[model samples]
Target: MTLKPLADRVVVKMVESEETTKSGIVLPGSAKEKPQMAEVIAVGPGTVVDGKEVKMEVKVGDKVIISKYAGTEVKFDGQEYTILKQSDILAIVE
Candidate 1:
């Protein structure tokens, strides 16, 4: 199934975090921090939200950094995803 966000919402899939540190120490899954980076899966059209004009700056396939603890988690067809408002996205990775 495909996801289509509406009104400045965004759908993203988390990118896997590295298993080892730069020092070559392998970290277990329980020790890994939650990944804050994700790839844009879908974007909503620009819309007026909270009495302000909100525009979507990211598009599908864009890599983005989001605020920690932001967005709602979802599971679809054995895959996980996050749905958040465009404002919750911190930056678009170049």
Candidate 2:
């Protein structure tokens, strides 16, 4: 199954990030704050809202940083994904 976003929404999957200490001990990703980094899975086409055009800045395969508390989480095909609006995406990671 695939998630296709609509109306300026975006679907993304969280990218696991790990931290390493100076001693070479790697800490698990679960121990950190809410994961804000994710990979763009699907993108919605630009839409018109309230007489304004809302364009999507992120595209599929793009790495982005989203708001910690934004979006809805969905589990599909045993994988987790977040569906959020384009405005919730803070920045795109180059």
Candidate 3:
């Protein structure tokens, strides 16, 4: 399925967290944490600021790191998606 983000909205698919610990330890399914990183799937044209349309700095396919507590949770077609404003985006991965 394809989706188009509208004005000031961005679509991100969360990156999966590792199931195993770095210290050569394994974690149970219940002990794992949700990954805070994601790749940008889609973004709105731009945000309106002071009656002007300001183009966004990020684009599709950019790996991004966002705040762990940002954005609104949403679901579509059995898949989870997060809708966030440009301000909520913390950094763009190189």
lDDT of each: 0.89, 0.92, 0.81
| Regions more than 4 Å wrong, model 1 | 19-22, 26-30
lDDT score of model 2?
0.92
Number of colliding residue pairs in model 1: 0
TM-score of each: 0.84, 0.89, 0.76
Model 3 ranges off by over 4 Å: 19-30, 51-53
Model 1 clash pairs? none
lDDT of 2 at 38: 98
RMSD over all Cα atoms, model 3:
2.6
Residue-pair clashes per prediction, in order, are 0, 0, 0
> Alpha-carbon error at 28 in model 3, in Å?
7.5
Give lDDT for model 3.
0.81
The best-first sequence of candidates by TM-score reads: 2, 1, 3
